[model samples]
Target: MSDPRPVPQYGEYATPEEVAALRGTAAPGSPLLPQPSPSPAVVSLRGSTLRRLDRPVTIALIAFGVLNLVQFAGVLLDFEGFLEVATKGTSAEPIDFTDAARIGGVVLFVVSLALVLASAAIAVLMLRQGRIAFWVPLVGGALSVLAWGVVLVAIVLQTPGALPPAGA
Candidate 1:
């Protein structure tokens, strides 16, 4: 038997209901439109509030720490040599590398290294939490300097001729 429906020259366009029915989302008689599929979600490893300074500050802090640690290590290895180089242009004289001075150098190195590591870790944590963390490195540097100064002062007091004479 021949089909009775007329053949159109143009391509057939299915209605919304027909399309939904074909997908089994709705009955062919229903007027509702098909719901759109959800788009993929995006994930971020770091917080959105990370400032431009965060990364630079962290790097600078680490660099400073490493440099300071290297210098401290050199001083610890040759306490008298470090003192001579440090006092070269100044009126101050290099003190004998006594046990006290060696101890002080060790203390300074340990404290400074610890502070640097701590500050970097804290800054990273703050960044992860979306907090402003630029101050961490600055504060750590200040504290490290203070600790070094205090230890140096104690060592100098223990060993004479570490500094220039009061008259000079």
Candidate 2:
């Protein structure tokens, strides 16, 4: 190793001035330093009505959310009875809409119920103002809106008289 020039050697006695400086009279190399303090940029959303739910409750809500909202679209779309001739002694043409609408309504209602639970979980997550709390709720709300849009499209696309695509 190269010798360090200006390096202090062992057995060197400390001066009274150096000792005082070390104690509290030390000069700072940089005078512009700021004292350490807690960060002031914190953000939070815990006050919303969604924080009351526990994990298991939210898990159940999520499951129902996916099931009801997701299936609601399929039911609204009338996937069944889309390609068939009128049966004898029955109404003209394929109009099997009873099942579709009922199922769709049930699914959507269930999802709406689950959304309440999801709201609770989201509220809980926000209590600490953790990074996740901010994004999770924002993203979830957007996704739920998108899912509703999809359901609307399904409803529009599959009116009673509408037919399914070929081979569907």
Candidate 3:
């Protein structure tokens, strides 16, 4: 009996069965079809030389660094006044302004200098994409936040007549 359909020639539209056969004939370990190009995100992540910091962390570091520098400037400009405001009602007896100002100014200067240095180091590390760059900002930002909280608490605690009297 004669076949019902004409035999398909090379380069003709292939049947599903013929396509399957062709796919099976491909050499082992070779793909039958070309791979799609990688997406932009994947491409960028590959073979990267520098480490990158998140935007929020970088901004926080810069803000804290500037704040410390500003605080240092304020202390330098008015050491006695800064001390008086810091110590205010927290103490019973009066503090010697001159002596305390000298000591407080030194401490503030050192702390602010350290903060600035840490900020600069973190910024460089971030640019270089160093692994340790992440931790530096995290720790520095936490410390900066804690320091600000303490200062705020001290100011609140010393607010003139904030608390009611012993009886009422």
Candidate 4:
């Protein structure tokens, strides 16, 4: 069976007979021009397919940034404490391990800073309704993982067993 359909032409308007033929409905008294449906930002956003998909990623990135800031502060403070105890005379203490930790701490600081900055960038993109914003959280998440690794490494290297004893 040949399915009868109305043909909508761009240059010319569609007549009632054409619409009737296309829709398989009754024809109107006059020709009906196809009007573009409104996809306003506000209305489209309510049920946007892309936004629905990105909602989880954006939330995770934002939360990750917040957590990073907290951890960043803690890392810096702990590094400072380690410095004070390390500067004392060469005892059986793990002050020597501080050097390695200092390096790890610096890495964590840079990674944390990057996470915060990346999150902001992504947020700006998202607010502008851009797809690039969706990738921002992933970058921050990666940085978070790196920062965690740095902390773990630093902790392992700073353990007392790895340090020189007193009067060394």
Best prediction by lDDT:
1
Task: Sort by lDDT, best first.
Answer: 1, 4, 3, 2
For model 1, the superposed segments whose C-alpha errors exceed 4 Å read: 1-50, 88-91, 161-168
TM-score of 3: 0.43
Candidate 4: tens digits of C-alpha lDDT, residues 14-104: 7667768879765665345554466776666656766776767676667767776786676554664665566567553543454556666
Instruction: Compose the digit string of candidate 3's lDDT tens values, residues 1-168.
Output: 765979878888976655656687544334775646798777665535223334445656666677767766766556657766877787522643554345445555566567667766766676566443445655765675665555445544555444456798
**Candidate achieving higher TM-score, 1 or 2:** 1
Q: Which has the better TM-score: candidate 3, or candidate 4?
A: 4
What is the model-wide C-alpha lDDT for candidate 4?
0.66
Cα lDDT of model 2 overall? 0.51
Q: After superposition, how far is residue 101 of candidate 3 from its true place, in Å?
A: 3.6
Instruction: Give candidates' CA RMSD values in order.
Output: 14.2, 11.9, 12.9, 9.0
Pairs that clash in candidate 3? 51-129
Q: Is candidate 1 or candidate 3 better by TM-score?
A: 1
User: Judged by TM-score, which candidate is best?
Assistant: 1
The candidate 3 region of ten consecutive residues with least summed lDDT is 47-56
Q: lDDT tens digits, residues 1-168, model 1? A: 665856545788767665675688875455675645444332122433356557777777767777877767877656556766787786765456467777777787778778988988988898789677878888998998899789878877887767667999
Q: Scored by Cα lDDT, where does model 1 land?
A: 0.73
Cα distance off (Å), candidate 3, residue 27: 11
Q: Relative to the unseen true structure, what is the C-alpha lDDT of residue 62 in candidate 2, on a scale of 0 to 100?
A: 52
Question: How do the residues 46-133 of candidate 2 rate in per-residue lDDT, one tens digit apiece?
Answer: 4323444434444554555556555655443443333232233555345544454444555555555456457547756654553234
